[model samples]
Target: MQIREATAADWPAIWPFFHRIVAAGETFTFPTGLGEEEGRDWWLLAEPDRTVVAVDGAGTVLGTAKMNRNHMGNAAHIASASYMVDPTHTGQGVGRSLCEYSLEWARGAGYRAMQFNAVVATNSNAVRLYESLGFEVVGTLPEGFHHPVHGYVGLHVMYRLL
Candidate 1:
């Protein structure tokens, strides 16, 4: 697989899995009824914020990630990122590759650290992946996320020093 910066045209391929993941209400905090234009606006960040896609040899998009400052001004040194992998492509290292690429980008961009503010507690795969990648759970908000099936679940704040 190859990882590259995403273009506006990439949205057509990204939206399908992005829509499914968001609508599932399992991991991401995105609202269920997010529209196409809104999703594009949210995912296809501009300028210093970066968005990238992981594609197979045939050029099929397998996953995507967006990285940016966790906060503005004085807090800008801290970076944050989000990832989405095609459900059909899970376990094929798509998510891992995107995450690794994002970390490299963040470090190269001079970020002091990276933080994930709202990782769903029940998403063990993601939690494990983050831990394996050197992130630690700094805190958890009890019953912070309302999972569709599991009801209220914790949201973990994870951090890693660059």
Candidate 2:
């Protein structure tokens, strides 16, 4: 697979995975019914921030990631990012590649560290992946997320110094 910066035209392709992941309520914290317009504005980075896509050899978008400053002004040295791999393409290393790409983007953007503010604790696969990638669970907010099926679950704040 290949990773590349995304263009606005890629949103249509990204919406499929974005919709499925958010609706599943298993990982990301986006509203289950988050509308396309809102998703577009949230995922498409026009400037300052960066957005990317992981595509297969045949050019099918397998996953996506977005990276930006974790905070404003004095806090801008840290970066924040989110990743989503197409469910149909899960377990094929798409998520891993997107994550690695996001880190590279963060480093190139001059971030001193990367922080993930709300990782669903029950999403063990993602939590494991993040850990394997060198992110540590800095803290957990008890009963922080309302998983559609798992009910209340802790959300973890993960971080890694770049």
Candidate 3:
């Protein structure tokens, strides 16, 4: 698999899985009914920030990530990234590849650290991946997220130095 900057053309391939993930309301906080145009606007970030895709040998998009500053001005030294792997491609390391790519991108972009502000505590796969990658749970807002099936769950604030 290869990870590369996402182009506008990739949106079409991204939307199907993007829609499924968001609609599932299991991890991401994006509204369940978000539309394609709005999804593109939210995911396809501009320069100084980045959006990327993980693709297979046949050029099938397997996952995507968007990386940017966690906050502006004085807090700009910290970076943040969000990832979504195609459900069909899970367990194939697509998410890990995108995440590793984002970490390198953040380091190369001069970020001093990276923080994930609202990781759903119920998403064990993600929490484990982050922990394996050196991120630690700095805090958890009790019952911060409303998982579709899990009801209210904690939202973890995870962080790591670059």
Give the TM-scores of the predictions, in the order they appear. 0.99, 0.97, 0.99
The residue ranges of model 2 lying beyond 4 angstroms of the native Cα positions read none
Model 2, range 55-125, lDDT digits (tens) per residue?
98898999999988889989989999999888899999988898888888889989999999999999999
Q: What is every candidate's alpha-carbon RMSD to the true fold? A: 0.5, 0.9, 0.5
In the range 1-162, model 1's lDDT, one tens digit per residue, is 999999999999999999999999999999999999999999999969999999999999999999999988999999999999999999999989999999999999999999999999999999999999999999999999999999999999999999
Model 1 scores what on Cα lDDT? 0.96
Residue pairs of candidate 1 with colliding backbone atoms: none
lDDT (0 to 1) per candidate: 0.96, 0.91, 0.96
Task: Assess the local accuracy of residue 162 in candidate 3 as a C-alpha lDDT between 0 and 100.
Answer: 95
Instruction: Return the clash pairs for model 2, or none.
Output: none
Model 3 weakest 10-residue run by lDDT: 93-102
Give the distance in Å from residue 55's predicted Cα in candidate 3 to where it truly belongs. 0.4
